[model samples]
Target chain A: MVVRVSTAPFDPGAETNAFLAAGRGAGAAVTFTGVVRSSPDDPIIALTLECYPELAINQLASSIDQATSRFGLLAATVIHRYGRLTPGEPIVHVMTLAPHREAAFKGAEFLMDYLKTDAPFWKQETGPDGTHWVEAKAEDDAAKARWE
Target chain B: MKILYFAWLRERLNRGEEEVSPPSDVATVADLIDWLASRDEAFALATQKRSLIKAAVDEKLVAHTAPVAGARVVALFPPMTGG
Candidate 1:
């Protein structure tokens, strides 16, 4: 029902509370958070996300609409962060509420899967050596496509 | 036309976006790449690997031969690495 995208740091608890409150009649809420890992194989000192402002938000909204119908969820929320972020920072978060745990879980997973591969954001990793571009993985596309 | 660059493609080109009027002959995405490559050595180097670059016409992914006549936004980038 709600999609919040911003560059500022996020509060997962606040998002969870809002989703739960909005779907009080629902039986379950599932939340997923994606955080940066401290240890990258390469010398990735930090990660910076770049996105085309309008296009990024539009793509996310469209995907959310598709997911809502596929998962039959009562409510859902998606939050994505931009700008420079060090390791261990949360990059994305998704929450879904449904009449049952099964739907909630599936919906949350579906949102993340699509966001991973289909979202319009790009990641750049900076290190002492130099900055390098991250490559998109085929596995993520396949994961998202499974639901289709 | 507005050309936007993202990810490594930006670094490789050493320039984010620039307005260019492709010759009347430039029509397809691949044609644009070839024309862009002729601009300078950097552009040529950046486009050396066509498979590594992904193009979107007016914000939607397009095939290599996709026409770009009225594209408002032409984005060049490597495949997305977002999660």
Candidate 2:
């Protein structure tokens, strides 16, 4: 598993290509990208993400380890970016490779769910009104609980 | 020991990190939070919603009941909204 936490934006296509190239024998691959969203009602200008870098990396690595073991994944990578991001920009990318399609799909979803609840990155949304911190959703915690 | 705050907790406290000795009575994370809250009004406000607060010891997530005695670094923050 590879985990990257940075302020720089990354190309999801390129990341997927690189990951696929390395997993030669893996029969299935799944990839997911999370983007900063803005709605017509809210009209957000940007999203600012703050992170505890050391802890984020450590927690992501541990989550990846659990995903791999549970799903029998051959390879996985998670790249999460912090700092201010404009709407439509990618905020996170997750890719998983496994011997079978079921494992590949489930692994990616598992990692994404864990990231939503456990990763130590906080988001603040900026808009015409001003900036306010995003609240954690109850649905997200429920999502994570399913895996346990 | 070093204490770190992040997100709204950092905003409320107006500082990201601080060093302090909480005496021997602060044996657990819950005890530590109560101790910190007593230091000032800002801390009291920040920790007002204990259920919304999360903690880490030496960068690893732990429960409020977790021991804080030997920890060199402890972080307190709001529930994560990442990914």
Candidate 3:
């Protein structure tokens, strides 16, 4: 398992390929990439992700452990980027490898669900109107509750 | 103990972190919030939104009622919005 909290942009394709290669025996591999979204009503020029780096890494490591044991995953990786990011830039990437497609898919979803609410990162969107902190959605909490 | 703030809390508090030594009566996270709220207007305002605030002790999320007696680090922030 690999968990990285970085401020630098990364190549998702390269990371995916490396994970797939490392889990050569795994028959299924699933990857999820989240990108910054521009607001339709108001034009968001950039997004700033603020986080306590040490705490963020620790939380993500625990998440990987939970996903691995619960889903019986062969391998997993999570890369989350903090700092300013323009719209359309990659914000986070998750990849899961398992012997079966079902496990791989479910594991990826589990990681993403946990990361959405459990991670230490907070997002602020900056646009023409000015900057505003993004509020946590109740839907995200509900989505995570399904796994409990 | 080290007190850390994040997101808008950090911005509103006008600082990110500080070392604090609360009185012995400050035993729980809630108690710490109450004590902190008395420090200044910014803290009072921030703690006023208690329902919207989330906290972590030593990097682990916990309830406001959780014990803070032996905690080395405490973090306060809004709900997470990451993926």
Candidate 4:
């Protein structure tokens, strides 16, 4: 298990290749990357992800532990970035390895679902007009509830 | 104990964290919020929508009713919107 909380930009391709290469017994590997959304109609200049690093690390570690046990994952890596980011930048990356494809996919999904609603990070978007904190979506909460 | 705030709450409160010492009767997280709201109108306004606020005690997430007696640090923030 690996969890990274960083402010510096990271290369998702490198991360994916490294994770895939490090796999030993697992036959299935899944990497999910979440990128900042850039809309033409509602263009954002920058996005700020604010977090409590120590608390975030603790929460993420526990979440990874839960996903690993629940899905029987062989290996997992989660990298979440905070601070200022531009449109199209990668924000979060999740990688999971398991013996079967189903477990690998589900484990990554579980981590994303948990991070979307419960993790200790808040997103704020700065657009042409102004900066506003992103509101939590009911749909995201519902998606996480499905796992329960 | 130390208290921290985040998001709009941090802006609304005009600061991120502060030291606090509540009365002995302010036993629970809900009680602490009530006590804080009573002491400052900005806090009251910031927490007007109480259900939207989430809290953590010593880096561990907990509900509003969680006790605050033994906590060394308490943080309050809005719902997460990160993936």
Cα error of candidate 4 at position A77, Å: 0.9
True contacts kept of 1: 0.68
lDDT for each residue of candidate 2 in A68-99, tens digit (9 for 90 to 100): 99999999999999999999999999999999
* i-RMS for every candidate: 1.7, 0.4, 0.8, 0.7
How do the residues A10-74 of candidate 1 rate in per-residue lDDT, one tens digit apiece?
87888778777777777988999998765545556899998765666766777778777887888
Please write out the lDDT profile of model 3 over residues B28-66, one tens digit for every residue. 999999999988788999779798888999988889999
Ordered list by DockQ, greatest first: 2, 4, 3, 1
How far does residue B33 in candidate 3 sit from its true spot (Å)? 0.5
Return the candidate ranking by lDDT, descending.
2, 4, 3, 1
DockQ of 1: 0.60
- Give candidate 3's TM-score: 0.96
In terms of lDDT, the poorest run of 10 residues in model 4 chain A is A18-27
Pick out the ten consecutive residues of candidate 1 chain B with the lowest summed lDDT: B74-83
Could you estimate the TM-score for every candidate? 0.87, 0.98, 0.96, 0.98
DockQ: which candidate is best? 2
Question: Alpha carbon lDDT of residue B61, candidate 4?
Answer: 86
True contacts kept of 4: 0.79
Model 4 C-alpha lDDT per residue in residues A1-148, reported as the tens digit of each score: 9999999999999999999889976799999999998888989999999998888888888889999999999999999999999988999999999999999999999999998987899999999999999999999999999999
Task: Rank the candidate models, highest TM-score first.
Answer: 2, 4, 3, 1
